[model samples]
Target: MIVSRTALLETLSAVQDTVSQLIGDLNESEIKDIEDYLGRICRHLRCSRNALVSINKLPSEILGYIFQFIHADFASPSRSWIEVSYVCRHWRRVALSMPSLWSVVDLRQKGFDVHKLEAFVQRSKAAPLTVFYQNPPSDHLVLRALQDVVARNMYRVRHMHVKADVCPPFSDVILSEPAPSLCSLSLWHKGPAFPLLHANSARALFDGRAPLLRKMTISACALWYVYRITSLTHLALYNSEAHWFGDSFVDMLDGCQQLEMLFIVSPHLRLATEVEQQHSNRIVTLPRLHLFYIVRVVCKCYPLPWLRHLLAHLEIPEYCDFRVEFWMTDREVVPEGSILSIFPPPAQFHPLEQVATVKLLTTSTSKSCIAVHSKTLFIVAHGDAFPLGLPNDFLCPIARIVIVNNTETTSFLLWRTLLSTTTHLKTLDVFEKYLDTVEFIQLLCPDLGAEGVSPVRCPGLQTVNWACLSYPDVDLLFGLMAMANDRAHCGSPMRAISIWPSVNGEDKRTVEFDSLGAPMGYFTRESTDEDCPCLHVVEGLIAAATPKRPDEDGW
Candidate 1:
């Protein structure tokens, strides 16, 4: 007879109560027998409950596909696929039966479990593997065990990334057999700058063959071996040596005509000889190239000829986006009257000639950053080295729109130098937080008075939008009214002017119009609802909520 669920629970509870009373009266041996019998009953009940769950009815193939999304790696062994298998016997069977679910083995992680690695290889069957090895301990027995397992499956290995402070013994030795399935490889050496394997040894390291190799990333030492692989479509060279460029570099570029993306970073340079000059003079066109990026991390010294030489040689399509960036640190402050070096003349560099819009931004960190439109040329500089004056005549026709955000008085003064450079500037948007209101008004709309000598800096500027910190005082309000009156007399009235003051709370806007019924924008004040009765503490709260960086301002 089939029993109801409630009756089953009632009977089980009665049996449990009786067992509990008998356990107290029984001898140790008799209690052990009862415990074993009870264990079997609980296990059977759990299994029966699991069978009733709807998910247990899924086909093995569907269950296996779902298990692939479990995201297991050696980094966090507790969260690996082994955890999923522990839920039920049927789930464990399904997970174990799927080979693709155990393909990527990241052995670089701490807590190296040889059993799990062995299990992965066993369950993977014959699928190709993607492996990452970095910072593994030097346990000889453990290393030997891992090597043996990899040796048995080396032929099926495909994508591998090896980053280690010190080279592991098996790194080169594992490639003794040709990996027919291998396609992508990235090797990073974070240790001292020592020569990687010799050119011949390096070529032989990969058995002088990887017919299907399409992408490779190598640093200083092994770059000479790039020519051995002509089938490459994407290449990245990090921390490249001086000797790698000119002929060898260009030859590598020539060989990889199929390359679509190229990235070079933090490359040191040496003065180019006449032979290198001849190689650079020869134009190398990459028809398939779409994106090229070169970045130098910190610039203590100006102008790297090799980079200039590399840019001069490549003839990429107009549709392609080419970008170059040089970072200037606080340690390298610009010498007096030499700030123009930061903004090099367009003719000097072929890429900067096409810049359309320029943004000069000052952050609370006492640093400034410039971003130029051409889909390229982003300069990040720390400390105060403003790009002032017209660096060259090339920028004269290019820069039409300018935006400046200055948070300190020092940066505000530095920005005036940049404004003087662009003669044809149409729109100027200024955001300043630390400047005197009367002085700011005098600079924008100078009080000609009886002298009538100085003129507005940007004569072509038709529209102006300015924002600054505001108080309850009338100084800024009277200063803006005087500014509007001056602009009307000059016959080039501002198309629109918006003065925004960052007060304590929500924004309140009040607009006005001129005698001719022309609409003039208004200043924004903090909402009255946020008015704190405790006036003494308002400053502290405002300071606490203010962001200290440009990015922290949320755009």
Candidate 2:
């Protein structure tokens, strides 16, 4: 898999050439590589030959059903489901017969020229067309073909995603005709595609005939006129252009009463906060909304006032998944308490317990997730720097917490503030990256006699199934032992401590506490690299509850 590209290509050429000619062109080292390549290819061919009969035994109907799963998103230029047509005569016939197979067209593939696209359209027949065109080149011929092959078929188009830089004429022609079957429309104006598509032009989209439109996504420009359709269930509005969301943003949500999911991404909320209190008498009620996600990038406005202003006008349900993220790649530090505005008040979505579960997620790209059930709301954060802490007013009753580590070096103060929020924390799970195991144990260790030391954080913290470790060292074991003993000295006891090998093998360190909150005996796992489970670790952590402690002690 790691062979050089040149060597691979040379070997391939040698296989295609005559043996006499291949030997003449190669040195001793090259000859050995050629033989190895030939042997591998021969094995591959033999395996394919042996399995060909059984695979071909499948009926055409089943084969077609299998082919349906292979869509345009899964295919690229070098390889594609279209390759099935060249396998044999029967396969080609089956592939050509299915109109639905050609419905989803990806116009980005270099091989799919105007003629091939036209052929696919003819095969698709009356099937509802789903077209994806991204980064269109500045070529007259290709643009003309796209306008003709796709823009002309507006009536039958169901889903259209166009991310390109086009003059007004092409953008206008895309939805010039009346579309009765249009359901989903996504337009991302990346490179100065006539910003906002002109207010007047967007208002007359689909010739005012699109009734079944339910989902619409507009980025780089906000098409505020889409509220004309009443059937919209999912709406996503992302505007990077400055001065876009004037004052009608809340008014726009108020118009569509059936929205189930709402996603918005902007540099900052451009709403007039004075409108925050002005709309107190008149609230926008989205009764069907389940998920509300908002992202702010290159933040220009303070998050607290703007977010609170937006939420004050909306009526959220009791049980909804709300996520607010700050993506300030500009490396500007956010204010200390601005994060508290991320959560809506209990009056908006009054939960039964009034408590929330929190999750903080950070990937290679400095993203943190915090989830809250009810009273104390937490969420997944998308921030450039994780400097701020979960302030007191942010949320309360944090019975659950999840911390997924990636590349960014998290601050000790931020982690301290996070764990200090709740005392009844049942579990603390972390995925290893930059944060060292020694550093984590240091956080749990009590700063008993230090000057002006804060109280112990998450004293009642329980089951911890550690996911990342550089290696099993004497320092790590000593730190774990210290964490157990120090926390016990603080009066609130800790629970089962599970340690994973430097690689990956479950190592449980169940520490039993006496009545007075002190560790009696605990389990520790010692292993060499060979003893550890041979697993390749990757990024991302799954949200899971810490396993319950068994009746017996360390095993």
Candidate 3:
């Protein structure tokens, strides 16, 4: 039945009286137990009634905030705030008139009606819009509905996300008119070829001035069409061969003075042909560029000398590489110095100490060891490049280390060194084959009189995420937890230790965890998934083991 606010409040008052009368006959302890149970019901009813009444009397601005909160929280398209509009006449008008609530339209559900989508767009009024299209490849109706919305209020769209197997063809109807309000555009095509759009059309779309176009991402496109995008602050081009047209790509960046973050993935970095190299003396300069990432490209050498030249002009502090092409030229190799020379000196314009995270994917041979520092380092080693002696100053300010290798000996050596040094290390994540050795467990908790170092040295370590896929040992697992408990009283308290049986899968069985005190929690084959349960155990153990003051006690 459709109930008014007055009627709902009257019903809640009656329910409250009944609960009070029932508790009147109970003793002190019984009444105290029932207090929590009855209080929840009263609070729920009161909130619902208050929301209904406030929908009629609250200021329009205040009502708009509540509606926006509800819209953002209800991400599912099937579960909308329209139910509030159905509550009563006044609520229906308030909800329908609040254009902000309808600004974000998510059309991800399968078999979503195009007409309903059109209705939603209309209800959004003239407010800036965000549209997410996540439908199947064959769902042409969804595309048609999106086209309809764009055609009507293309100027009002501020952000757009399209996730489909194949992007709908970009025609004059979709691109001829400029979307002046469009600031961010993310298009994901999970299919093979790029969407059908003329090169001229693509160029025209970006050639126009978009002062607020700060971020853009385009993945897996066919042709190389780069335009002058003047206002772009961040740009990402993935799985596209734009490097063949390097001149146009450089021209695009030359236009954007405020560009900061740039990512180019698996790009076909075409070298300058003999004719172009001889004729062109133009040097492209990106003065404002800071963070640049290059990944999985097939170029034999660093393709963009322009990028290196630009970095020489700026003050960058962090750098990363994934399958980058490092040229082995005679002049590039340093004789007796160190592998650290491979990295460019911190901007002479700025101080080297400002540098923070330096990550690389390389073989851990004696040569690569020179790059290791006391700062934050994330290394993914490959092949026989394991078990090398690391520097004593290794992990000086290192906070996190993730080692992904299959060598047991190398893993043991690295783990021992980390347990011995790295005084400030907070998280140690060891993956796959590294945890298979039986001796590593002994190293975790050395004998009292043994000359070897013990886990007690890593007093500041709070979390350990160890995944041992093969040869899982229950005894060694408990022993490690016992060691953590013994040392928790000293240093920063050890809150959680998560042990994953293997990298391929998790053991979720109900394992006994009573042996380890305050800071320890265990989960086996029956408990939960690997990473999630480990995170939960960490939080729970930290809360349980942390010391509290008298005034910090709960009510």
The per-residue C-alpha lDDT of model 2 at residue 394 equals 45
Query: Per-residue CA lDDT of candidate 1, range 121-141, in tens?
Result: 888888778777665455555
lDDT of 2: 0.61
Shift of residue 271 alpha carbon in model 3, Å = 12
Of 2 and 3, which scores higher on lDDT? 2
Backbone collision count in every prediction?
0, 19, 13
lDDT of each residue in 75-143, candidate 2, tens digit only: 346445677877766678888988887887777777667787788789999988988777546555656
The candidate 3 region of ten consecutive residues with least summed lDDT is 320-329
Model 1: weakest 10-residue lDDT segment is 520-529
Global lDDT of each candidate: 0.57, 0.61, 0.54
**Model 3 C-alpha lDDT per residue in residues 1-555, reported as the tens digit of each score:** 899989978987997797777865878887777678778877777766766774457886676667676776224655557677776555677789987767777787554578768777878888888877776767777777677777777787888777765434533445445778888877666776453344464565633645576888877763234345567788887767543334545555666677777776665444535213322334445556665665553333322443333333433333321112222223233223222222333433132333233332334332222132233344443323322233332324455555455554434444454446556656666565654454445555534313655444566666666666653454554466566656654435554566666576575222222322343233333323454444454344344434556786632
- Candidate 3 has what TM-score? 0.48
What lDDT is obtained when candidate 1 is compared to the true structure?
0.57
Query: Which has the greatest lDDT?
Result: 2
- lDDT-based ranking: 2, 1, 3
How many residue-pair clashes does candidate 2 contain? 19
